[model samples]
Target chain A: MSTAIRDDYLEKLIESWKKEASPVHSVSYLDQLREDALDRIESLRLPTIRDEEWRFTDISSLRSMPFPRASAAPLPGLDKQAGTFLDETACRLVFVDGQYMSGLSSLADDGSITVCSLSELIGTRASIAERYFGQLADFQENVFVALNTALMHDGVCIVIPAGVSVKVPVHILYVTSRKDVAVYPRCLLIAEPGANVTVVEEYVTLYEGASLTNAVTEMYIRDSACVNHIRVQRESSQAFHIANGSVLVAQSAHYDSVSLALGARISRFDQKIILAGGNAECEVDGLALIAGRQLADTHTFIDHANPHCRSRQLHKCIVDESAHGVFSGKIMVRPHAQQTDARQLNRNLLLSDKARMDTKPQLEIFADDVKCAHGATVGQLDNESLFYLRSRGLTEVAARNLLTYAFGGEVINRVIVPSLKQRLEEYILARTRIG
Target chain B: MINANSKVLLEVRDLHATVGGAEILKGVNLTVRSGEIHAIMGLNGSGKSTFAKVLAGHPSYEVTQGTVLFDGQDLSVLAPEERAQAGLFLAFQYPVEIPGVANDQFLRLAYNTVQGHRGKEELDPLEFDDFVREKMKLLKMNPDFLDRSVNEGFSGGEKKRNEILQMALLEPRLALLDETDSGLDIDALRIVANGVNQLSSKDNAMILVTHYQRLLDYIVPDYVHVMEAGRIIRTSGKELALALETHGYDWIHANDQATGAQP
Candidate 1:
């Protein structure tokens, strides 16, 4: 009887999502990709706690909710919402409810890079889209990625030309303003050989009711190219956010990313990075600050496929009230990848007796001459350290919050963007505030 | 700075304390007055450090039976921060290293908190920086030390010096120095001693917990007390520290058998 109800729910969800496709002149390649995604989604079902990877994260709440796709409607007072923008950078792309808003975004006209909304440049950049779109992030078995690929309305496309250095950072802002709505946001970035650029991906919401945001991002760095990706998610606590990011690092290329999960009722971030050539390096740092029944789950896979590669990862969580935080990081050094150095650490702070954290760091090194070290620690405030602070005239509550703020600050300080860094720091302080 | 008629600041009567259900302080009694410096000399298990921790209200140490009066107010009921706010300071033997908090920021916060409690005007960052720099000179600390995390990667002597540096900033009325001279070299000892001596005034009292008389050579104490088996069995002038250095603790254990018994 239970299986019958579950099967019926799956059929209903898929039927509702099929209509989310663009109702305009569709390109043949993208239509074929969408057909493939739809076929994959039909074979998969919503994950339960019984699955090994989903054991600690129970997304059953999302499976049973309404999956209504957002309709394109002009948002009132959008100009007044400019406060959500970062520093004055002309190179920004805006997407509201999975649809690109051309009037709300500005782009640098220097011609050093190509930034476009796939909806606007579908005719001219179809070749670029055909080469990389729906490629890095495999949707073979992942339902969320498959759904995003099948339903993405307007996707972000960035191309840094060869040997060009794009000094102006590009910002891709994803906004959700409707309740009971599911928004699928997509992005693809390709840095040519010896080219460099920075991209900021932000997910925010003006909706206070149950909402869903499924985002997919794919990045490719060519030989000697460098890319910095900073992803920030600060949605309403009543929203559910799931994101998948795939990156490929070429010979001697560098990838640096810092992702922060500060708000959400239930959020999961899945990232996979592949170092395809020798001497490729990547630094992936993440921080999740959740409280009051919120749950944040992060899973990362780094594959050192070539020789002489290095990967560094540090993920931290500050759990307060009855919130839960989960981290699972896997670093793999292929059999032939020698001289690969990898370090991964996950540290958690439990502020309340009911707060929970499940952290796992897995390192699989097949090379004989490789160095890989991983560690995870979950603890409350130190009694000795607390006493030391209280002895210095700080109240017990003040001392505890300070220590908690400092724990999350380690990752926040790594953000070189001054305004964003300060914003994250203040968010940590406010969340850890003691009454 | 000693005056026989100085006002009493801290008075402990029949104190008893246990750590992890093991009694470490038994029936210890002491009286401290303003304008005086007292040196406590003892062996490892003599409970001198435990007494200092209990006075500072360490959480691990439970006062099974005791009554402590700080400036004639019952000190047992107050919290550790309350004690600190009421002009009490303990220089930990092993100072803790706080990683993310800058040394200058921690010191300034502590100073301002204590100053606010005392109803004194608080100084801004510029003024406090100028003032603290002058105080750091007494301990021969570099200005860059303020920029680093509190005591993180500091040498043993540097940690001890930081303890004294805090002493100068807080200006507690009753200070307890718990083995502050243990990790110091000769040069560091001189600098620390000079700093403590300069912080001492006619309205403040300090008790130095040490195991050797060498510290007494630099910071001359007005009185010296010998603790044996959780009790102060002997109290005399500063000359007693010299006698204990030469005679060792063995002979004094035999003389204090009367008061050394566990209560």
Candidate 2:
């Protein structure tokens, strides 16, 4: 819709990217869908800062390089690190370089849920995939999702039957070990009527290398169903990560998500939630801790299409050492969507003089009887608070680190998985810990 | 219980300080000996609180002309934390709120730091919990306060009690109680005054900065000095506080006018 994305440089880059051969696949069931995505990719060009949606995020550096696909390889030193596995998880799915590693994964079938790779799931669950796959996440509006759909390898799929509730969370760990390569990660989750489940999707790196990760995730919750999604991306500083998440909530269904971005040279996460049925609800929260020339951007859009929908969101960022953080959250209440309650808040802490934060809260309300509120703030540490800590015998560095750590603790505490929460706490501490 | 080897803990010589290009504490002098408590009574904006903050090395206040020595060492050479580690404490008039940092953790760190500086053993979490709880009893604070964020959502009296609780834990050589009696009910005042009285000993001293003479009834000071216009206009025993309470401050201005001095 914007002319900025159609510039000559990006158009040439898009043409070159399209010329590259598609990823090899054996799943012939979705050949036509993949073909349709590839054709759509040809018409869409890369976005630049001049575009209204990407004014603060500059991705011209990505157009300068050609990141080819990589084949399956043994993960380097993953046996020692376990690739950040979480405790008390019902099932664990491991993907290395966009290829599913069955040897490193564990599956348990209790007859109430189904979790498997897309390839192996094609036989008996073909109907489930055919019905929900590529349904909610439209590729026409998003270039990253279209690219991911056109070149994705194997993906993880989880289906919860009706009238059943899953207690433990499902863990999906994506590991990046190859440098100078592009990896496409996909996830499809479907909660049937009255089903309930929790999922943790984490992207980590086994080595520090330059890479690109394009991720697309879709979640569908039917009537009275509930789902909790926790997505963590702590990739290497040399990596560029772009992810898109699309969610749909039915009548009386609930969806909650927590997205954390800790490490990435440049990262952008776009999340869209649609309350399609009456009385649907969602709680979306996020945190981004970055430093040393890193840039992290988050864009969220919540649509209240039906009456009696509620959306609550809080996004925070701790920027240090010349790092830049950006957040733009938009909530839309349609003309007929009465009784809609929406709230958004964005708070940022800039630790260094050069650290920067760009925050904006957009509310588009067409219904006169709806309720909506939004606020944003950016500031440094309070001098009085710092002196108060110092007066009590704490060093200045220790005081600063403690305050910075506490700023992020509010979002990290929302994680339900114990081991994962502990890991995240440790991660934040290590980042803010004084030498 | 006085530490006889180093009796005189603080000596402020003609202290002149300015904040935001305006002088607050001008030409003030005082000496505090171990085992002695002094009360500085003054009206609002008379620089009593500024004097305490200056001694505690607050970054905002600048000592334009002054010499402060603590135990024969120049106080200007130490940073705020270093001064704190050197056994100097200042209870803030308005306790700062530090959200998300638990009171127990902050108290233990402050205790262990000063203890380490004094060559004492550091306590673990369990040990610190027991030790802090015993000290919290001095102020009659609830055990739930230990888990709350420091001064966050605390009532005015609770904040004042937390300050005194910290004083009991640190056991500083010289404690500057800056308006600690403000914003406290009579019951909270008695509890805070009793806690301060218990924390004081012959080995340590205190300088109570207050506006009213009501607090003097609970903690009887050895000396009381009336401050006016950034300087101590009169120095006398505790009777002077009662005299000021009864006679009011009008006679001081009359005396200042008679002596040809600024009121």
Instruction: Write the residue-wise lDDT of candidate 1 on B1-263 in tens digits.
Output: 67879899999999999999999988988999999899998999899999998998889999989789999999889889899999999999989888777799889988988899999988898999998999999889998999898899999899999999998999999999999999788999999999999998999999999999999998899989989889898888998898888878776665456557532
Instruction: Considering the two chains of model 1, state its CAPRI-style docking category.
Output: medium
Candidate 2's displacement at residue B3, Å, is 11
Query: Which tens-of-lDDT digit does each residue in B113-196 have in candidate 2?
Result: 788888999999999999999988888899999999899999999999999999999889899999999999999999999999
- Tens digit per residue, CA lDDT, model 1, A1-435: 022323454667667765555534477787788778777776778788899888999988886676777865777676577447778466889889988888888888978898998765566578888998888999997888988887777788899999998876788989998778889999999999999988889999887878999999999999999998899999999899999999999999999999999888999999999999999999999999999999999999999999999999999998989999999999999999999999999999999999999998999888899989999999998888888888888889888887887788788878866777777777777777732
TM-score of the second chain for every model: 0.95, 0.95
Which residue pairs clash within candidate 1? Answer: none
Which residue window of length 10 is worst by lDDT in model 2 chain A?
A1-10
TM-score of 2: 0.94
lDDT of 2 at A52: 92
Model 2 CA deviation exceeding 4 Å by range: A1-25, A76-79, B1-6, B255-263
| Highest-DockQ candidate | 2
